[model samples]
Target: DAMVIQNPRYQVTQFGKPVTLSCSQTLNHNVMYWYQQKSSQAPKLLFHYYDKDFNNEADTPDNFQSRRPNTSFCFLDIRSPGLGDAAMYLCATSRTRDSIYEQYFGPGTRLTVT
Candidate 1:
């Protein structure tokens, strides 16, 4: 089925090391989003790309950066992995930014910091 794809479903990194997680979609959606979710906590929107325009949540930290090299792919770069950063990183896509369009999410990449 055409859907969002995330690689390396699980990742292990040492503290202070940089790690990158990737996402891709076959849905050909115009908007892509990245969310960080901790255990039992609601997912937080890190950033999104509306075509080539990047929209990052104001509260998102500098440690978290994203890149959408093209329409079909996006990458999340964690400048420095921290214990607090260990969580599920999810990638989603929507037809538009409109509320009426539902976002489809990827299975998610679970990060473990040593």
Candidate 2:
């Protein structure tokens, strides 16, 4: 089955603290990405790894980072979460340039700032 998975479906973070969210995929996709979706708006790409080739979105905040150690695992690291960081963090995957831009998304990690 094609599926992307994100753990702890929800996360509560304190201001100025670091937090990390994890993602995994069973789809064996070559491209894996981390995105921040705030306030039901369009998902913003933070960064992604295409089979070890990392690409970061220019508009992504410096406070956000990501890594993909292997094909199946990826992570989103927040150096210091601000109040504005409270939002749904989505993990997505797609076959490398499969012609279709469609991506499979996980349930997402909803981060709450306290």
Candidate 3:
């Protein structure tokens, strides 16, 4: 049995190094999203992929990018991580926009910069 999973629930990154966080789901959903949630703040949408459509937030920085090669997987590529980039990265999924349009999130990948 396979399911949506993110390796290393916690990630320690440097101030200006590149890091890649990954996500995979088994629900066979078509829409996958990545969000950055800071302390007591809203989880801001960084980007997402509806099938093959890659949507990025208007204010998202160039340092943040994503890739979804297939339906079951998506990856968040954080290039040149900054101190501000340290936060909880959440991965969510949904089949179609239904009443339960709610997305299922992972344990979150916490990034720490030294």
Candidate 4:
């Protein structure tokens, strides 16, 4: 079965600390998204990697960064995380840009900023 897996399902970091969450997929998808989901709220798109290209949401903070070294792996780096940054970090992948309807999401890494 095709799936996206996020490592370190739960992460805890001190305020102003840096953290990196990793997501790897067995689907070999071309488009990957890094999103943040707060309680009872929809996921907000932070950035995406389409093959080798990176696209960041206009409103996404500069503290958030993403890297996709290849089709199967993606990473999200939060520089100096604050308490407000605590949320579920999700990794989603679609086969193509037009196939947004068919995204496979990872279980997600729940981040906690102390």
Worst 10 residues of 1 by lDDT: 94-103
How do the predictions measure up, each by TM-score?
Answer: 0.95, 0.93, 0.92, 0.95
Tens digits of per-residue lDDT, candidate 4, 1-114, equal 878999989999999989999999998789899999999999999999888899999999999998888889999999989999999999999876453557889999999999
Poorest stretch of ten by lDDT in candidate 4 = 95-104
- Evaluated at residue 97, the lDDT of candidate 1 is 41
For model 2, residues 43-71, the per-residue Cα lDDT tens digits are 98888898999999888888988878899
Clashes of each: 0, 0, 0, 0
Residue-level lDDT of model 1, residues 1-114, one tens digit each, is: 899999889999999999999999999999999999999999999999999999999999899999999999999999998899999999999986455489999999999999
Worst-scoring 10-residue span by lDDT in model 2: 94-103
Name every residue pair that clashes in candidate 1.
none
Task: Give the true-structure RMSD of model 1.
Answer: 1.6
- State the local distance difference test value for candidate 1: 0.95
Ranking by TM-score: 1, 4, 2, 3
TM-score of 1: 0.95
**So what's the TM-score on candidate 2?**
0.93
Off-target runs (Cα >4 Å) in candidate 3 are 1-3, 97-100
